[model samples]
Structure formats: structure tokens, C-alpha cells
Target: MHDHAHGIRQGDNRRLLAVSLAITGVVLVVQVAGAILTGSLALLADAAHMLTDAAALVIALVASAVAARPADDRRTYGYQRAEVLGALVNAVVLIALSVGIVVEAVSRLLAPEPAPVAGGWMLAVAVVGLLANMLAAWLLRHAQKHSMNVRGAYLEVIGDMIGSAAVIVAAIVILLTGWTRVDAIASLLIAVFIVPRAIGLLREVFSVLSESAPAGTAVADIRTHLLRTPGVRDVHDVHVWQLTRGAPVFTAHVVVEQEVLERGSGALLTRMQGCLAEHFDVAHSTFQLEAAGHEEREHH
Candidate 1:
């Protein structure tokens, strides 16, 4: 048996997340104050969403830092999965915030409350918030591709930006015509964007937690390739799962000829690991090279 991992590292995302965390924390305070002064549901919803963004960035920073630690005997796989856990939490929080905003918006729409909306003030605050969210989004854009933690933070800022835009539009309508219901309408629209992004994040986190195959990985192709390798007569118990985002692990049993096992077994193992690394981008793999009929013995 052998284990092969190409390259796995962490901590690189911490700096980006730290900057984002600071920006979100400051923006959250501003938005909250704006919501209070203007009593705009759209601004309030955007503030609430910003609060989650701050929390997500904080968790992402910590997770990235923890995952950077080297592997030890007590934890051979290291703390790489912490990032996925952080992402999972972020997704849940986003869903809750979205639901809360939607419910509040619906109530306001139906009840038609006399909201004290300061159009000019809310518009100014929202524009500032939008700029801040855009900056944070740009900082996290590149890292979000391979790291779920980064993606979670990126999505939050994007959602916040959308909410801010909706608030801006509402402010314009309120400024031009004395319509307060536009605020509630804008909040409802913001919720619409939030829910879909939250669902996507949830799906990605669940895939990792469930040990599902990583995106784009083809199990059948891998099996066929292994069978074609020299000295490999049979393949069974093959499995593939992601240890974390961008880190795939593979395990399988390969039946070999008796003579091949005795003379050049080590070489075959290297070839199998190499194929997985080069072709499939699989970093870690474990192969149990056995004599023919080993699969039958396992059943008993």
C-alpha cells in the first residue's frame, strides 16, 4: 500500500480574508446606523447581511490559518477540512438572513406601515456601502475559485452589494415620488438574490461533507486507465473522494499476476500513483496491490 499527495498547503488566504473582515466590520456598523436613522427595511436588510459577511470573513481567516498547520501523527490529514466547515456555517447563516429579510419585507408590503425613510440619507449610505462591498469582492475574487471559505466570503459581499443596489434604487424612487413601499419591494428583491447564492454554497459544502466525488472527476475513466496498466489484472473496491476543496483522494485494490508481484511490484505501484497525479489531478491515492482472487477473499 502507498499514499501519494501532489501538493497541499494553506494559510495563503488569510491575508485576503483579514482585509475583507476589516472592511465588512466597518461597513456593517455604518449600514446599521443608516438603517436606524432612516428606518429603511432595505438598508436594514443590507446591514443584517453585512453582519453575516463580517462573521464569514472572520471564520474564513481562522479556518485558513488553522488549515495551514503541518500534518502531525495525531492528525495525519491536518486541518484542511476546517475551511469547508467554515463555508458550511456561512451558507446556513446566509439562508437565515435571507429568510428574515424576506419575511419582514412581506409583512411591510401587506401591512403598509408608515416607514420613516430618509431618501437622500439612505441613498448616500447605500452608495458608500456598495463601494465597500465591491472592494471586498475584488479582493476575494481570485482566491474564491479553489477555496470554499474564500468563496463563502466572496458570495456574502456580492449579496450585500446587490442589497445595496436595491436600496439605492428604492432611495431614488422615494426621492422622486413619495412612495415608501419601494423600500419593501427592494428588500424583497435583495432576498431573491441571496437565496440562490446560499443554496449554491450549501450544495458545495454538503458535497464535501458527504464525501462525494469532486466536480469534473470521472470514476469510470480512472478505472479503465488502471486496468490498462501493465501487471494490473483486476480492479475492485475503487473509490474517490475529496478530502477538502481541490484536494482529491483515491483508494482501490489492484490484482496483479503472481510473477509481476514477486519481481516488479514496486514499479507498478509508482505507475498507478503517477497516472492518478498526472491525468486526474488527484493529489492523494492509496492502492492495495494484491494477488489475483484477493477480491473474493474479502467477502468472507
Candidate 2:
């Protein structure tokens, strides 16, 4: 990996997140105050979603910082998993928030209450929340593609933005049609949007942490590639997994011809590693080379 590209200029994102975090905190406060002042469920729901966005951004900032740490003897793979862990945590929090929203929305639906200040205040707050969510989402967009932590944060903000838009539409409907159930309906819609994103984040993080082979990488293909290499007799015990979001690691036992053993087998292993890295994007690789008959005896 190129030194600059690996650790690159992350400070910009840190600074952006810091600014966005502060703004999000303010938005949460404002939205909550607006909710209480007007007794508006839409405002309250938006406030709760904003709180999630703020927490997600904080986690993303911390995870990105931790992931930038260099590898050490104790942590051979370094701290790249920090982003995955962050995503997992964010997903858990989102699920909890969704549960709370569902409960509140159901209760509100059972006995609908008139939202104070009619529709004007709700619309104003929803508009403000929408703008804030959009700004935060834009700020994190670039970093989101770089790490799972930011991706989780970006999704949260996007969900919040959608929720805000829903609230705005609900307020408009209430203003025109006087249908109060629209607020509860919008809350349910927001819950629907949030749940799948949370589940996806959880699944992706768990897969990476479990050392499951990444999507599109098949063990059979890797084994066949190794077996097809000249002087290689067979390949067995193949293992492939992600070292991080982008770097995949592969390891296998390769049976080689006896003549190749006398002649520098190290070169063969090096060539195999290069091939894996170049074609399969497997950065870290290990290969145990053995003579044909010795392979079965030697626990590959």
C-alpha cells in the first residue's frame, strides 16, 4: 500500500465531523424543544432521529481515528476493525431507537392527540431538521465510502433526512385535510426506512468480524489458481478473508514438485503471493509449501 494513500489526510473528515456533531447537537435540542412546546409527535420523532445521527457521527469520528493507528506486534492486523465495531454499535443503537419509535407511534395511534400550534410550527421545525440532516449527510458523504463507520453515520443522517421530509408532508396533510393520523403514519414510515439499514449494517459488520470470506471471493477459485501454478501439485486448506474493508488475506498449503524444492521454493511462494495480490486483491498471504508425498502426512 502507498504510505500516503493508506493513512492519508483524515484530519479534514475529523474536523468536518466535529463541526457537524456540534450542529447536530444543537438541532436535537431545538427539535426537542419545538416538540415539547407544540406537543407534536412529528417534532419529537425528528428529535429522536437527530439524536441518533449525532451519536453515529461521534462514533464514526472515533472509529476513523482508531483505524488510522499503525499495526503492532500484539495487533498484527492493526485497528482497522474499529470501523466494523463502530458500525455494529451504530446498528444496535438504531434498532433500539426503532423499537422505541414503534412503541411510541403505536401508543399515539391508539389515542390520537391534537398537536398544538396547528401545522405551521411543525412544518417550520421539520424544514429546519431536513436542512440540518442534509448538511450533515453531505459532510460525511466522502468519508462514508472510505470506511464502514462513516457509511453507518451517513445512512443514519439520510434516514433522518427522509424522516424530516415525511414529517413535513404530514404537517402539510394535516393543514389541508385535518387528518391527525398522518403524523403516526409518517412515524411508522420512518421506522420502516431505518430498520433495514440497521440490519444491513449489523450483517456486514458481523460477517467481517467472523472472518467470513468477502462477497465475490470464492475459495474454489483461489484453490484452482494455486493448483494451476507451474510446479504446484495440489492446494488445500485454503482460507480467505478480509483484512479490512478493502484488503483481503489468503492462506493455503501448496504441494510442490521435489525438483522445485531443491531450486528456491521461496521465489515460488513470492510469485504466488504477488499473483493473489494483483488479481484477487489479497494483500496479506501465507503459504505452506510441501513435497507431494509429504503433504498428506504433514497436516496442511
Candidate 3:
């Protein structure tokens, strides 16, 4: 039943990503042309940023589709981790692109003379690019809340929007002051906007890849809750981690009174699972009911 609902959500996410990709693709071509015509480093940097965003959206789109595949004998968890991997790749690409832009901007700033920039052409193209970015952002806004892959694409679009704005500001400054160096300065600002968000996303990707417990969920708190259940003497080997965003998996060895075992472990198991689902928002859980001192007889 849950699988059916998840499939529906994945379908919606893919549609959103596709539309956003189309918008970005169009803007990317326009920006590239504008950059070449105006010889504005800021416009060129923004175009480069859009190019990567378009690629990232493609990766995210493919990953969203792959994540819908069912588990098989060879891959028990299915392809859900594909989304995480997609996010990882997006973060790495963003960081690398930002660093490259920064390096180029620095070199341009150090050049003997500032590069010529056509402020009028740059401004017109930047305005169009900013509008396209705004549209793409609106399309992905809700979907990003549900999937990390979508979130990565959404962040990239937002960065592109900022880059476009910087380009516009640089264009206006150049037009008023005849200062071409503002173009390089705008590229630096765009790069600055990208690095921190990319690093933050990378941190989240690592957390999921390492199988760390989801934020705000404490293993100790789960242990305490399980121990409070009727007939449960102790809880050990409690493991909690997420397969992906919003999908948490839990496993624990629960020691219960012999009387409860004699009465059948079924009811106790149900109670514990219910407790986890209700309190911890863990829907998929496995508990091994054990007789008192069962762990003592087993080699650790």
C-alpha cells in the first residue's frame, strides 16, 4: 500500500523535474549566446552555472525514476539509494564548478586591463535568465520538500537565479561607471553563493551514505521508549537509520519477561512496533523478542 503511494509521489517529482529541465535548457542557450556577444565574464559565468544546473536536473530526473524500482534478490533495498547518489554527484559538481569560476574570476581581476563588457546586451539576457530561473524554482519548490534529488536541483536553480541577478547588477554598474572589473566581481559573488550550499548538501549526502540516524532522532530515546513497553525488560542492539528521506528502518533485540513469552510474543511485538511508529515515526521496524539472559548465553 505504501509502495503504491510512494510510486505516485515519484511520478509527480519526475514531471516537475522534466518541466524545470526544459526551462533551464532554453535559458542556458540564450545565456551562452549573450555571453559570447557581450564578452561579459559575469554573463559567461552565469551561463556556465546554468549549464551545470541543466546537467544536474537530468541526473536528478533519472535518479527519481530509478528510485521507483522494486527490491530484488540481488538488490534488496531496490534503487532508492540512487537518489542519494544523484544528490552526491550534484554536490560535487556544484563545488567544483564554483571553485573553477572563482579561479577564473580572480585571474581576470588580476589582468592588466579589464575585459570589455556590453552592458546593454548583458542586462537584457540576464533579465530573461532570471525570469526562467524563477519559473523553474516555482515548479520544483514543493517536490524538493519530499526528495533530496529534487532539493539539489532546486538549490542549483536558485543559485543560477542569484547569478543572473549579479550579472544584472554588474551590467548596470558597468553602464553607469564604465567599470568592467564589476563583471569579474559579480562572478566572484556568484561563486560565493554556490560553495556554501553545495558543501551543506555534501554533508547531508555523507550522513545518509554513512547510515547515520536521521536528524532529531536519538538512539537513546528510542531505547528508553522500548524499555517502557509492558513486559519488556530491556532493549539492546537497537539500530535506527534511514534508507532515504522520510523512510526510516529500525531493528532491536528486545528482552521480555518469560511470562509474556508464554502468553505468546505476538501481542508484545505489536505493542512495541506500534510504540515505535507512533512515537518515533518509524513505520518499518523489526524486533527480536528474547527470554531474559538470552544475550548472556551468546558470544558477543
Backbone clash pairs for candidate 2 read none
Instruction: List TM-scores for all candidates, in order.
Output: 0.91, 0.86, 0.92
Q: In lDDT terms, which candidate is top?
A: 3
Task: Give the distance in Å from residue 260's predicted Cα in candidate 3 to where it truly belongs.
Answer: 2.9
Off by over 4 Å in 2: 1-16, 265-267
Error of 3 at 224 (Å): 1.9
For 152-211, candidate 1 gives per-residue lDDT tens digits of 889999999989999999999999998999999999999899999999999988998899
Candidate 3 lDDT over 188-214, as tens digits, reads 999999999999889888888899998
lDDT string, candidate 2, 74-166, tens digits? 987778888888888899999999888889888888874644445778889889999998898888878776567778888998999999999
- Residue 134's lDDT within candidate 1 is 97
- Per TM-score, the best of the predicted structures is 3
Model 1 CA lDDT for position 42: 95
- Each prediction's total of clashing residue pairs, residues at least 3 apart in sequence or on different chains, is 1, 0, 0
lDDT of the candidates, in the order given: 0.88, 0.81, 0.89
Clashes of 1: 1
Cα lDDT over the full model 1:
0.88
